[model samples]
Target chain A: MFLRIDHVGIACHDLEAKIAFFESTFGMTVVSREVNEEQGVREAMLHVADGPNGSSYIQLLEPLSPDSPVGKFLAKRGEGVHHVAFGVPDVAEAMGELGGKGIRLLDERPRHGSMGSSIAFLHPKDVGGMLTELVQAPPPRT
Target chain B: MFLRIDHVGIACHDLEAKIAFFESTFGMTVVSREVNEEQGVREAMLHVADGPNGSSYIQLLEPLSPDSPVGKFLAKRGEGVHHVAFGVPDVAEAMGELGGKGIRLLDERPRHGSMGSSIAFLHPKDVGGMLTELVQAPPPRT
Candidate 1:
């Protein structure tokens, strides 16, 4: 049902400092940056490596407001892996399939995600402890 | 230094049930399973997807003893992501490089990990509240 790991979203209190640490310490590179108002996050995608399907990323997320999801995550759990997104062909289909199996979804339908992707989240409680995301990338530009 | 995410290790109280969850819900398949005495955990690597570099996995770890590291994690934080392992060409070199950057090391030297890999862990405190592992996979059989 899934393709590969799209990205690992990390909740960061200080996105700049954390990005620097990943770059200087781990030698990772930043491929893209965006501020998603709907998601209430200022995020950057750090390139982990290149491969056949596509490049994987370590996504650093800093909430724009304290009431946002990432903000709440940092307030409760501090800095850590927030969620893991698996690449899917269709986010809506994946959501429907999982929901049919008694899984709780945070999003009723696909929502806009970073890099023109459609995404929906599964409830962490129902996922056995980890917040899971289903991401479907937009078709390649002609 | 790091090539790609080797696996995301998740702490589970019941490995059987969790593996079943991934299989039934996400359609992930178990690629490998192992019991590591030194790590004090029974682990199974579930295939997330395949790529040029290799396949990524969601590793489920169940502590053999309550006193083990995974056990302590479950007791304190409940079931969730235990650690994220990054693939590297040389475990010792990666350890030395990170150590030189003042990042504390949980293992002074590479030790046996699940599936005959050389692995060393980084201190979670220094790593922004998430345990990190550097993994050097065994060479391909000739």
Candidate 2:
């Protein structure tokens, strides 16, 4: 049902500081950045150089609004991993299967994620105690 | 220098129950199990299916004694991801680079990890609040 890790979400009070730390220390390069007006935050992605198996990304997130989810997370937990995302072959199919098991879905349908990927979130309460996200890559061009 | 994800460690109060959850929900199989007396815990690994470029594993760790690190982690954070381990090409080189950045290392040298992999840990304080582990597979046979 799952492919590989799409990215790990990190909530940060200072996104630039975190991004600088990874880039300076590990040589991770920023791949993309975007702002989600609806979510009220901005995100940046850093792809690992020579990453495992040719796939891996680090996501740095900062809340644009004080009341956003990332904002609250940063206020309470400080800078740290916000969630782990697993790459799913098909987001809709995976969500349907999880829904059958009484798992709570954060997104009823696939939504846009960093770097043009489609993603859906699953509540951590249903997935043991770890927050998990389901991500499906956009189909390759023919 | 990383190759792939070795495993995501989850600290659990009921190791068996958590192990069962992944097994039943995702059909994960245990590839290895062990007890690290120094860390004071018994560990069970669940192999992730269709991993990126290679295999991925979920490590469920239960404290052996109440005074163990796993036990203390559980008391403080409840059940969730304790750390993320990435398979590196050279554990020593990675540690040295990280150390140069004043990163606080949990282990000064590479220690034995499950499946004969050499591993070192970085303190969360030095890594933006998320524990990180660097692992290197044993050198290939001649």
Candidate 3:
């Protein structure tokens, strides 16, 4: 089941500048940063506000290679929103349910994602032209 | 200050079909629906999940005329994410602050928006090419 909005992925040429803009303008704080070589992206997760399930984030993505997905997106569309991610209780279950309902998926199974979460992407063609990601984080420790 | 994500504006060709998709696929419910002749669009607000300050919504927008802003957007880029709206305590103050910080604004002043909120738009050229809206709602009644 969908829990809350996890993060809005934003593609940017300069992650630090975007982070600074968000911090000064929107009062957001970068809580985590990582370079995902597999995804060919340098990303920073900025905490924006609290949601019902957890905090929402503005995920700033900077491409590490010109051929990467974000890089291609930037080349085609320029910098902008790359994807919208929703927090789910279970990524596998959500993907199965959506696939059963006849929605096309970019990832057939849950895959590794930033911030230690299992994630899968739903095809934009089937999701009203919005690249959407479903993320399931590890259960909170007691 | 930015409170929480109020909604993500999504452009669609058919409001009903998109609403059905969200309802069946994401388990969202339509909380509000209206046709804004001023904006030349029919919109449906679907409740996705709640946040600390307010609930987050998926706002489906269908253009009413070919010359409308959304209509032009759909014509040029096809249906997709249109804009992201953030809830704010005061629209005027937020706009002034952003303007002072050199952010170009689409709206010089807060204008009437759906759900009776005062809303202003920031120019996408200055916002990493993503259209952003700031919304200030009337105080909730006790």
Candidate 4:
């Protein structure tokens, strides 16, 4: 079961421009940034003030290469929401439950994501054509 | 200015199936449902539990006809999230303010949405390439 919304992924042609748009319009603050070569994306996470949960993030993703997932998304959809992430208590457990239901996962195992979270992706084809992301927060830091 | 998230719109080839999917998966309850003949779609709203501001909703949309806007979305992107809606204090005021800033309005005038909310749409082309919806909640009963 999901606890709350983890983040909303937005695909952008110009990462900086898009970041500025959200920051200026909604007063969002950058929480972290990363370049994921495997996913072919350079991403920045912006925290929304007074968000739904204790924290809500706007994930701005730009294609790192011509053949990256973000690149293909932008090419086909131009610029738009890529996916919606749900916060799960445990990524492995959530993946197992979903898989047992005949769901096809894009990522069979959890991968490192921004802000020290473990994440996995579910294939759109098996989710009623909705790209879904599962994010598990790391244990509380002492 | 955006008050909060009103709902996230998901375009589906089969509204019934998609509705069942979220309901069974997330334990969501339908709060409202309606058909907009002009938009050529049937929509069912599922309230996302334990969400912030009591505004989180999942909007499942199925095209009523082949020429519907949702139909076009499904044809282009398959079944997926189509737009993000934000709650606003006043639909007209928000439109005027955003319009003054040169934001492109998809529905230049406010229209009736489910549950008697007044709504207007902003084009993704002008809003960082992400389709946005502005909704003004109906007055509370005495």
Off by over 4 Å in 4: A49-53
Q: List the residue pairs that clash in candidate 3.
A: none
lDDT of all predictions, in order shown?
0.88, 0.79, 0.89, 0.80
In angstroms, the error of model 1 at B20 is: 1.3
Task: For candidate 4, give the lDDT of residue A100.
Answer: 83
Name the TM-score of chain A in model 3: 0.94
Two-way DockQ contest, 3 vs 4, winner: 3
Model 4 root mean square deviation, Cα atoms: 2.2
Model 2 lDDT tens row, B1-142: 5566677788887778887877776557888889888789899878764433345678899999878888998888788888888777789999998898888889989999877789999998777788889988776678
Fnat measured on candidate 1: 0.75
TM-score of the B chain in each candidate versus the native B chain: 0.95, 0.90, 0.95, 0.93
Query: Which regions of candidate 3 are displaced past 4 Å?
Result: none
Query: What digit string (tens of lDDT, one per residue) describes model 1 on residues B1-142?
Result: 8777888999999999999988998888998889998889999999876666555789999999999999999999999889998889899999998999999999989999767789999988787677889988888789
What TM-score does each of the candidates earn?
0.97, 0.92, 0.96, 0.90
| Whole-model alpha-carbon lDDT for candidate 3 | 0.89
Model 1 Cα displacement at A43 (Å)? 0.7
Candidate 2 — which pairs collide?
A52-B3
Error of 3 at A39 (Å): 1.5
**Number of clashing pairs per prediction, in order:** 0, 1, 0, 0
